[model samples]
Target chain A: MQRYKCIVAYDGTGFAGYQVQPGKRTVQLEIEQALSKIHKGDSVRIAASGRTDAGVHARGQVVHFDSKLQIPGERFKKALNAMLPRDISILDASPVDMDFHARFTSVRKEYRYRISLSEERDPFLRDYAYHYPYPLNLEAMKEAAQYLKGTHDFTSFCSAKTEVVDKVRTVEEIIFNTSDDELVIQFIGNGFLYNMVRIMTGTLLEVGSGKKAPAEMETILAARDRIQAGKTAPGHGLYLWKVDYA
Target chain B: MQRYKCIVAYDGTGFAGYQVQPGKRTVQLEIEQALSKIHKGDSVRIAASGRTDAGVHARGQVVHFDSKLQIPGERFKKALNAMLPRDISILDASPVDMDFHARFTSVRKEYRYRISLSEERDPFLRDYAYHYPYPLNLEAMKEAAQYLKGTHDFTSFCSAKTEVVDKVRTVEEIIFNTSDDELVIQFIGNGFLYNMVRIMTGTLLEVGSGKKAPAEMETILAARDRIQAGKTAPGHGLYLWKVDYA
Candidate 1:
């Protein structure tokens, strides 16, 4: 069997999640069904770099699958796109070395959260961004982000539902870009625990809104408890921006 | 009673149209219902600058109405917004002179059509932009726009259903701005007949795609027949960007 790597993008509004459930519609199920149709009824399973929750969109999600089909990369992309729904797109596909495992080989991941800071909620952006609708101290948020960077056992930043026991992860970068009335926060990390990005955003927003001080971040991280963090931001504002592989 | 003018923005995907059609959900119907709710079940009518087709969005649609309520404009704005759905937004509201009219007193209107130029259709922009996958000669489109940007009887560039007999209208400007795989075509004109902007865009696209010559626009304009122009572009990609009043 030949291994193929594909970059996928999806608007997750109508999806249950990235992973397949028995009856729920998901990104994985859609892709696998399309692949099965192409292979004439043979079951084809795909491994994604990670799963994103329902309503969390993706711009550059990476996945790998094994196939015996002889179609070239570009032709395969077109074929998959034709079979998939409008909300999902196969950005690119290529045959890869069998050594490339989508999950284990991923070197880093980038996630982006967008907030609409306008006083009035915009109708067009209601679904794509979190409506903050409050004053924010950018300097305070940046100060708190400094405490979030580097290696840490981010137990406070993840959800109680997270199954992974090893919570230590290296968050390499935390970027904040404010443009027009929208604020885009980008996080780059070797790996993130479930709901880590959303939790971090919620905590940073609390700091920015003066509900918490920048120094509180240090204590929150050291607490090593989920209760120490702020509320989890909504899934709709978050995007799986990119997944990088070595 | 005080005459008030309001600026509105809406995502038109869910609306039937801007006008009140019995048994159909329209933007005007929603606004009127909201006003009635605020007025203790008293029906209130409003006049809009113009009507937009179903799935045609608006950014600065202007409307005017007379109200007997003693509330301030800003407070009324807040009240209406609280009553309105998430798909429609009241951007601003202020008292206007009784002589002012939304449709008749408008000096000009600006409509914008966005076209996605990328070879691959992006899922995020599918509802907001018209995806034209073929290569386009922008220079040719601009050259054709020159012929379209003058006072002329736009019979060929409007829907056959247009009611106005005097089709003469002044198109003051035709501007093109291309950036990041999207092209925005803006038309600023004294007035537009029904489906005028969409038909003009379709005709211009034909010239850009080498299906028609730039000079052919002049002949089409002279023909004074709807069949002389290209197909009307889809309503989803059109925006009533702004309305100006003297």
Candidate 2:
């Protein structure tokens, strides 16, 4: 058996997210079906670094699978691309050690959220950006984002539906950037919980809008209650940017 | 009556183009509907810098309309934006001279054609760009584009379905640029013929693929037949960048 690793990109629209659901379309099921076709009369299963929620996009997602076929590393990418849907693309394919699992090997992950801070909605960017007509105070949001960095129990920012037993996670960096008409929030961490990034974006928005203070982050963190955080931002504006292995 | 000139942007995916079509959605129809709603019982008609064909997008399309409503120019923009659909936007609105007409007063028009040269289709950009996987010779295409500049009889390049009596037109500038995995073809002209931009893009792609030479432009021009030109590029890739008046 040969283990292969692949980097993938996908527009998460028209999908029920990355996991396999009984009645809905999924990125994993589509890729597996394509792999089955390429492998000729045999079924193939693959695992990804993480399970992104519905409507969330990805620019640098990684996955791995073991196949009995002895296809060259280069041919693997080309064949998969030909069989995959237009929305999903395999950027690269390479042979990996048998023990290198996509989920187990991933050590760090990065996500970026986009907010359009303009009064008028942009027609071209309607689907990809979250539109907020109200002006935001960037200084306050930046100060609040700084408090989100470093290791902490992010229970208050995670969704109530999360099944993870432990809520402790290390957020290595949180950066805020602004353009003429848009605001970008970037977060890098060892891992994330269900809807954690969206929740963080909403909380930061409240800070920027003067509804919350930057120092309130500590109190929210200690509460360990989902209701202590702000509402979750829309999934469309979130992008899975990168996955790192140490 | 006050004449207002407005700069507009739209995603042409849902419209039958810029012009009003019977029983079909058009950018003009959407804007006019919004104006009527905001003006309250006043049915305002709009005239645009150019009547873009079906499926052609715009970034800086100029339009003018007259209304008797007593409101500030900036407020009109805000009102129209509130009433317009998600696919259309009024970027700016201002009072203009009574003699101004968006079509007749326009002095220059610029357009861009986007072609994706990647091996895999971009599902996110599928509706916004044309996908061509073959390797293109950008230098050769650029050289061929230069020959299209200056005044020339574009009868060969113009679509035969056109209703205009004149086929002669002057091209002020034509440029072809290639980035990491995309090709952009820009054109500036006094006016364009029906289906002209798409035809030029198609002919240039032929040149880039080595199917045609730079000198063939002169021959194609001399042929005075649309069939002699290359295939027409897809409509989704073309965008009306701007209209200039002096």
Candidate 3:
């Protein structure tokens, strides 16, 4: 048996999410189905670096699978891409050591959220960005983002649906960038909890819109309660930008 | 009665084309349908700057329509946008002089063709760019593009299906730009014939790939025959970037 690692990119528009759920279309199910076909009816399971919510796109999602097939590593990319739908593509594929775990070995992950401030909706970017017609105070948002950069208990930013007790995580960097009509926020961290990034984004947006003060981010973090943070931003605006492993 | 000029944008993935057919989903049909909805069953027609082929996107397509609805120009934009499908959007709308015509009054039009030379297909840009997975000489393509600029009889570059006899058209500019993995070619001209831009892109790509010499563009133009040109590029890679009227 041989283990293979691959970097994947997907549009995520039509996918239920990254995980496999019975009767639901998902990125994992599609990739497994394609892999099963290659394995001649044998089931193939893949482990991903992380799970993305529905409508969340990925630019460099990493995954690993063990297989007995003797085909070359480069050929797997071509074969899998040919079978995969247009929205999902395997960017790179290579054999990895048997001990390499896609999820456990990841050192850092980066996510980007795009918010379009254009008064008019952009037809092309409708699926890619969250369109917020209201004016936002960029300086206020940047000030709030600074508070989020560092190790903290992110329970207030996490989804209540998760049962994970260890809500502490280290956010290494928070980058805020602006163009003419869009605000891009990038988060680099050791890991993110369920809906953590989206909830954080919502909180920053509220600060930017004057609904909440920049200092409120610290209060929300200190509360360690989900209700203390703002609402979860829509998943369509979120992208798993990149993942790092060592 | 009022004449309204609007700048429209569309993904064009699900659209048959810009023109309305008996039983087809088209940009014009969708706009007219939305207008008719606003007019309470009174049929409405819109004249576009030009027709785009099926699968061709648009960023700044100009159109004019006569309406009896006594709504303000800004309100018209909102109402029309609400009625139109997600794929199409009215970027801007305003009342125009009754004498203004979308097609006849147009002085220049710009079309963009994107060619992705990356070996891996980009899932995000799958619908917007053509994945040509081949080495291309960018310098050769730019040199060939220069030969096609300016006033010329472009019979060899036009589609054979076109019935328009006067093939003499002035190409104002040809801009060749490159990023890390994509080549963007923009053609600005007074007008384009049926599939003219696609043919020009294909011919230039041929020059870039070393399949045809850069100097051959001049010979192909002088031939005045459609058979002398390269294959027509796919319509999906084309975009009606902008239209200007004076």
For each candidate, what TM-score against the reference?
0.98, 0.92, 0.97
TM-score of 1: 0.98
Error of 2 at A75 (Å): 2.9
The TM-score between candidate 3 and the true structure equals: 0.97
Best-to-worst order by lDDT is 1, 3, 2
lDDT, candidate 2, B28-89, per-residue tens? 98999898888776788999998887777998999999988767878988888888998898
Kindly list the per-residue Cα lDDT of model 3 for residues B126-223, writing each as its tens digit. Answer: 88999999988889988898899999999999999999999999998999888999889999999999999999999998998899999999999999
Off by over 4 Å in 2: A39-43, B39-43
Model 2 CA lDDT for position A166: 92
**Highest-DockQ candidate:** 3
Model 1 CA deviation exceeding 4 Å by range? none
Q: How far out, in Å, is residue B74 in model 1?
A: 1.7
Per-residue lDDT for A1-246 in model 3, tens only? 999999999998999999999999999999999999999999999999999989999999999999998678789999999999999999999999998998999999999999999999899889899999898998998899888989999999999999889999999988988899998999999999999999999999999899999988999999999999998999999999899998
Worst 10 residues of 3 chain B by lDDT: B65-74
What candidate 3 gets wrong by more than 4 Å, as runs, is none
Ranking by DockQ: 3, 1, 2
Selected candidate, larger TM-score, 1 vs 2: 1
